[model samples]
Target: MASTSGSTRPSALIGWRVLALVYDLWPVVAMWMVASLVFTVGYTLSGHASRENIAPFSALQWGLWLVCWLITGAYALLSWRRGGQTLGMRPWRLKVVAADGVSAPGLRALMLRFAVGTASLLLAGSGFWWAWVDRERLTWHDRASGTRMVRLAKR
Candidate 1:
């Protein structure tokens, strides 16, 4: 990991970072809903349509889970890889970038961000709160993925 000590890059504050996440959730949810519909149809077609079998699902449920996971991950990945800004990040003037704070992140880095970020969120946002006390003010996803959410200068 590169030490960003004394770097002049402006990292987004936690509040702005969170709000951008909130903004991004809309599309993620929308995409997940679509993925869920497909999963439901697939499950039904797989001869598991019976009501009694639906509640206590088999390990095959992981298929649906993975599909939804990929749907959301693709959203974050493409946005960061293409322009470094998701729709949510734009209004807030936020951009997701590599540790260098300039280069756009590649697929591997973006995937790490999504996986670690989801884990962070699932942990009652402890990873996010870590920034409050971190010397560099970086969240777990940021540090783990070597990516940063930077605050852009006003246009």
Candidate 2:
């Protein structure tokens, strides 16, 4: 474990960030499954047939997508608020903090980070690749949110 005690922590590299994202996918998928189950139950209870799946591009399907998004965001925001790391980040000793590298980022910043990160993914990770050329080695989300991901030294 790493302590958020000093300003000397190194910024996390793209590889570490990608690894954490991959690891985080497991829990996120689990959450999405649970959300899907709830939606399925609600849909069935609303007089829909038991075997019917949410129709593609229908309003109900869109609502389910939105719910899943919110659920994922809640998982991320709450984890970041409670501690600087998510389950995946903990393994890599990655911590999210203010740009100065020692304090927790505010909720607004975390939200911004999440939004931009989604955009980054949608754009085929151009924003993440930008870090390779950025002077500060920051991704779009990091800059937009005024947050930095640091790799803490091993204990």
Candidate 3:
């Protein structure tokens, strides 16, 4: 394990910011997309597709959405909580941490961050695109959660 003693300022570059998002989020998003399709299909099949029938989300349909959200949420929370990185991030040697660069975030922190991330995606993904324009290359969720994705220093 590697440790940095003093200040824990992040040294990851802008390029890595873009790369990290692409690498870490693509599979996650893909999974969510597929699950969403399945949920849509399942709801439609169950006669709950229209707003009149499922405007507030039928029990079955809501259950499916909840399950899907939990799965993705677990993936994000566990990855960051356990390794400070997702599978995709690990492959690219990227790690996420608090601004102070601690070992790993606590469970509550991870969950909060994940919730913020979810909200960002729900907002038409302008949050994701924020990185492209922000000086620090941070997305809205990143700012809201006080988390930073950093590149693990080479051994």
Candidate 4:
């Protein structure tokens, strides 16, 4: 008979998972919001995009969207490459680890993960939904990156 004494499941509670989600997502939202405000207000103040030339608003929107994507990608890549925790995630005591349990993620893997994350959110939350059913509770990005989030080990 197979012994199951030491083996344990890797999962977290719905509430902790929610907390983890909030903790991991808020920074990305905040960055986008702040960038939007800066771009809109600055362009309006500069008169480059005023009531008379509101066409610039459309351009500004697309530019800021691209900027947000770059910023998010850089953040995810750097965090995973450095400490396995994004700014928001660290506060919540969560860290991303590879399936093999390594602390750092590769650059290509980070890019792929972030890209899948973008696509997932673009289609309504299916990427995040993967976390709900995955045995290891991995988001689509996590699956792509071959990583999983876990509570930080005690010091």
Best by TM-score: 2
Clashes of 2: 0
Which 10-residue window in model 1 sums to the lowest lDDT?
Answer: 1-10
Candidate 1 residue runs with Cα over 4 Å from true position: 1-10, 47-53
What local lDDT does model 1 show for residue 13? 74
Native-structure RMSD, model 1? 3.9
Between candidates 2 and 4, name the one with more favorable TM-score: 2
User: Per-model C-alpha lDDT, please?
Assistant: 0.81, 0.88, 0.70, 0.69
Q: What lDDT is obtained when candidate 1 is compared to the true structure? A: 0.81
Ordered by lDDT, highest first, the candidates read 2, 1, 3, 4
Task: Tell me which residue pairs clash in candidate 2.
Answer: none
Tens digit of lDDT per residue, candidate 3, span 30-87?
7878887787777777766444444566686678678778878888787787778877
For 19-133, candidate 4 gives per-residue lDDT tens digits of 7557767788888888877877888888674554446468766788799989778877888788877776666566666666545667777788779878988888788777777
29-148 per-residue lDDT for model 2 (tens digits): 998999889889999999999998778899988998898889888988999999989989999988899987788999999999999998999899999999888877789999999999
Tell me how far the alpha carbon of residue 139 in candidate 4 is from the true structure, in angstroms, after superposition: 2.3
For residue 102, what is the lDDT in candidate 3? 62
Rate residue 73 of model 1 by lDDT: 83
Candidate 1 local lDDT, 8-103, one digit each (tens): 644677898889989999999999888877767777888775453445465656777787788888887888888999989999888888888778
Q: What C-alpha RMSD separates each model from the true structure?
A: 3.9, 3.2, 5.7, 4.4
